[model samples]
Target: MEHRGFTALGGDCELFRIDLGGGTLAEGEAWVRQMHDRFTRFSESSELSQFNASAGDWVEVSAEMDALLRESLRAFDVSDGLVHAATLPALLAAGYTRDFSLGSTPTAMPPPPPRPLPELLSVRDGKARLAAGAAIDLGGIAKGWMADRLAERLGDNCLVNLCGDLFARGSGETGEGWPVGFGDRSVLLKDMAAATSGVTKRMWGPGLHHLIDPRTSRPAQTDLHEVSVLAATATDAEIYAKVALLKGSADAAKWLEGRAMGWSFV
Candidate 1:
């Protein structure tokens, strides 16, 4: 097995492949860096930043951007508005204006009320547009999307783990599956994906964190600190994990009854 590790998207990233050479690992690393440079919300010159700045006007987007925009819309529908991409303004108002690694100071201002994603964003004819006051931070959805893409590009048998959003493809060296760390134990995952979502990692104060509840447009006040989920794809896993966390312990289990292959909450 060949392995490569690097830091990107505000956290550690790693890629592993079976029956592949070092050059493939290097190429994967480069692609991850390129995606980070293009979509990172912390950089003003990034494509995502430029789109956020041009709210209310139609802006031409690359094919990659178009696909991601469409995925964001799909995420909204699948998660039932729980996994919103256009929660950047609410996140900023909650004092998550910078990358979590650098730390943040809480603000006293309240976030604006939530709005439906369909009402706030539209994509068509190689172009995309945001409503007058709407802005988006792709965040975990971008990571999950990138992981899935990287796995396909890496090889038939590979695992791409960008931060905690990961996709496992093909069989392992022994032909069982890729050994992945779940909540407290290692699980063999084959042709599946997993993602973890939480408020504990990024919290700055009593009520300040990055996981904004689209229902209230505030940092979610949930019983569980974190939740991990398994699904058919990294994108679906990401959406499931976030929705599970936001639903809190009381309702999370019932809501996730048949949605995930496996799940753990803490």
Candidate 2:
């Protein structure tokens, strides 16, 4: 068994492998840093930043960018437009302009109303475009997507954890499953993914957090503080958890029924 831990994408990251046969933990860490540099909106030189800057014009994109863009569109459809990626403006308006770990002082300002993602973004022929005023922050989607990618690259038996979003591939040393800490107990997961979404961790002020409700274009006001979900992929888990949290306690269970393999709410 081997383990590596570090920080990237504004959160703690970890990689684990059993009887390594594929990529090394060092290489996996490097790959994560590379992806963070490419996708992060904080860096002015990042591809995502460049894309955001090039709004209103079609810009060439790499294969990874194209895939993620398409995944963002799918998330929009899966969550019934609740898990929007084009909420950068709204996030900024909510005073999350910088990484939450670095602390930001948010001013009292209302964000612009949400716009339909499909209408503002389009992709074709290895190129993509966003409307003039439209910008996107991949956020949790990118983390989950990267985790799944890293898991594939790491080995047949490995786990990739980026913050609370993670992917577990293959069985663990015990051959049962990879033991993971959930709510109050440990659950063994094999060839599956888990993600937790919450407002408590990122809150900076009253009613200020990273989770933006696309319906109102503001921080969500929900009865539930957090939600964790299991799915076939980390990306799917992330989308499900966010949607459940946004749906609040009363309606979350019904919406999450049959959508997730397992779920817990707080």
Candidate 3:
């Protein structure tokens, strides 16, 4: 069985149970909504918006916010800065100031020089802060992270797909693993997760997307059409898949093995 609903992260939240018959779909929607309320960029009063507003100031945030911040930071490090979360400035400059479905509003301002997120992020106890002129957009990872987190609330035979990013727990009805169709082939997932990232989904202007190249503060010009990765968790899949897609081909392969993410594809 499958259930779908609009997500706070600008995509649909899809909950599926292999065997069906679980009365958790509504609860899963609620969980997804709760995460959206806290993390959505569309809401000015959301926790993430508050945190973004407090840039350059050490601000108090919810425990959930702090936890996700650290996770984004970890993604930043593991991807060698290719998958940086602090690309808000770049995104805004590219006319992605609002949701992609809303159509682009051109902005000519160039983004400020890119900086490593670790240099700007400071998280201690339950408080977090960013350096002056720094901002972070968790849209890069929150969907997958929230999917992984919500999977714990689901049954053993469940799959969570936040937009195209996916996570699988127990085996589906097939009894072997969850069948995920990608391109010309498919993969079985058991006690694992997968995610796909590409520049095609949310493009604006000539070639603008949430995936920004730190070296130029512009959308990365990767040659891969898309990347799919099955990993230990949704967040890891999101991070590594994106990194692989951004790197492209031989370099992406070497990067994945170097990072011990041999399951990633592009």
Candidate 4:
């Protein structure tokens, strides 16, 4: 087996293609291109983008989007609503709204006094409802979901990486499973997705960053710098990471233990 890597789906995506029994490079490229055309949010016709823009009623969806949202919502419910996309405006108002840039001068943004949680959450007819004053930003689960889908599409012998997080389906020709490293943290994965969430990588304020504690409806005051969770799916890992970060190390560990999910905090 030979491994071929390429950038596709979008400029931000990275994919690895493994040729079982030594297939042509062109064939692998074509397969990747097809997957990107179907999966990338920029594809315009993807069911996800359509759903992202839909409002007011249950937007009828294909089975794929339906499954994605359904499973993602499980994370929402489990985190006690801590990890939510409807709070985008609140996140921005706290100074995390800007594109992440290193070495930039920190702004003198005032601390946003605590505000009431927006009434933008509700579920009806088996679908999540976005309240009149809420917005849906799927940055939390979108990438992980895409990686999971790509792993499924590639079957039992490939790896999929979205930005930094990675999910793998099987080992390569070297008889080693997918090995992914982020900064100083590296891990092996086999049919699993590892998602990381933290405030260390985001902009800093007086004592706050992007990770907000939705439990108190404020920026999380947890002292831990980072937290990573391992679960059956990337969506689970992603949600657990955020939930753990907001809940703090002890509470996060207890929560994961109760749920039987793997986690690490630093």
Model 4, range 111-204, lDDT digits (tens) per residue?
3333222344444444554544444445667667766776676656777666555576777546576776642666677777777777766646
Among all windows of 10 consecutive residues in model 3, the one with the lowest summed lDDT is 257-266
Question: What's the lDDT of the predicted structure labeled candidate 2?
Answer: 0.91
Best by TM-score: 2
Q: Pick the candidate with the highest lDDT.
A: 2
lDDT per residue for candidate 2 within 1-266, as digits (tens), equals 99999988888999999957889999999998998999998889999999999999999999989989998999999999999999888888888877677787656566677688999889887999999988999889999999999999988999999998999999988999999877777899999999999999999998989999999888999999989999999999999999999999999989988889999888
**Which parts of model 4 have CA positions greater than 4 angstroms off?**
1-13, 19-68, 101-129, 182-186, 258-261
Query: Between which residue pairs do clashes occur in model 4?
Result: none
For candidate 1, lDDT tens digit of each residue in 128-212?
9999878899989999999999898988889999999999999977799999989988999999999999998888888888999
- What TM-score does each of the candidates earn? 0.96, 0.97, 0.91, 0.70
Candidate 2: the clashing residue pairs are none
Task: Give the better candidate number (2 or 3) by lDDT.
Answer: 2
In model 2, where do residues sit more than 4 Å from their true spots?
Answer: none
Cα RMSD for candidate 4? 5.4
Q: Alpha-carbon error at 28 in model 2, in Å?
A: 0.6
